[model samples]
Target: MSSAQNLAEKPKYKRVVLKLSGEVLRCSETGDPISWDTLRKICNQVKEIHQLGVQVCIVIGGGNIFRGLSGSTDQGVDRTTGDYMGMLSTVINGLAFMECLEKMGVQTRVQTSIPMNQVAEPFILRRAIRHLEKNRVVIFVAGTGNPYFSTDTTAALRASEIEAEVIMKATKVDGIYDKDPMKFDDAVRYDKLSYIDALQQRLNILDSTAFSLCMDNEVPILVFSLNDSDSIKRAIVGEDVGTLVS
Candidate 1:
């Protein structure tokens, strides 16, 4: 088969936004903020799909380093200041991811919503699109360049701006469950969910604002487990790998 034909058979979406939580990079065993082993595995999966010709954009959270809301309530940090600190943390994760991806021979660009001229390019919609068109992975960091917004919202916004076909969220659980699966063995997983149902039920797979943005944009969300070695590749190939929220 021609290379194009082979690639066509593999990816369901031409472009996608991958949302990752910073906690995924944490070393659970050592209490370290970033785990090279975990990062490497995730990057390899990203490389796998990129090789299949999928245009990938990434938005990762900073919860592993700090959470703004929690900092405000728990540590008495001012909300705006706490949020800015959190945003900086995401930039750190983005830089680490960019370095790893480039080392793997995959071209990548780190675009920040906030200007960090020395480390990354300021996000420009046209430039980001051009990078994807040229097959360079683009990692969007710094969370909307404002406080009072979650990384989830940033992912939804970037996905809509880039016209990504889907937002693939790598989570701890394999799919969205009625209850916390880790806590409740009887928790039921939904293979699919409608945005309305998810909202009415108050499912916390994403923040309400993020969910609403995606609903309005009509972009599907795929929630899958990062623990699964091949989950990302399976999702990209349109396999039944996780819960589908539309």
Candidate 2:
């Protein structure tokens, strides 16, 4: 069936920021950092939503390649230098993601906070908005073009700038749990949460900076598992697939 014909269902949000962790691209069995299969799966889902007429903005992390905080604390690297390495890693992931999406026939653009004219367009607010207006997927990368900040913060910042209706954060688990779901069998998943409640309970749905930014901007966040096939589509189509933080 044609993608247009498949759009019988409408998405809950017209525009959204899809937050992806670089770890999602890892191959567990092979221990490879960038898994083509995983990338393909993710791009396919993005394509699905794009076909549904949702303006997609993606912000991907670089944990799989490198983590600045971990490098600084664990490897004795300078914080600023480590963060710049992490930002470079995000650019690599963004380029790979853009390649995957383009191969899948979805129009995509990568904008980096740090200017890299040879590789991608510099992060320009007007240009990014114009890309979305033209139904192109815009992927923001390079960790806000600075050190001492995270991609989570970048996601929140970009969402606010683009005026995205919500931020869909794909994680390893199904939803936000009161405790570590992997360690605690009694961990309970929340169906929904208010920003104040999330803050009061200290639910680690996002980093403090990112969480506070979302709360301040009133941008809702949907936390869901990326392992499930069609989960993005389910969430976009309003199927209650994850924990919603508003």
For 191-244, candidate 1 gives per-residue lDDT tens digits of 999999988888987788898899999989999998989889989998888899
Q: Which tens-of-lDDT digit does each residue in 53-102 have in candidate 2?
A: 99999999998999999999999999999999999999999999999999
TM-score of 1: 0.96
Query: Clashing residue pairs in candidate 1, if any?
Result: none
Error of 1 at 92 (Å): 0.4
**lDDT score, candidate 1, position 82:** 97
lDDT of each: 0.94, 0.93
Where model 1 places Cα greater than 4 Å from the true spot, the runs are: 1-9
Worst 10 residues of 2 by lDDT: 1-10
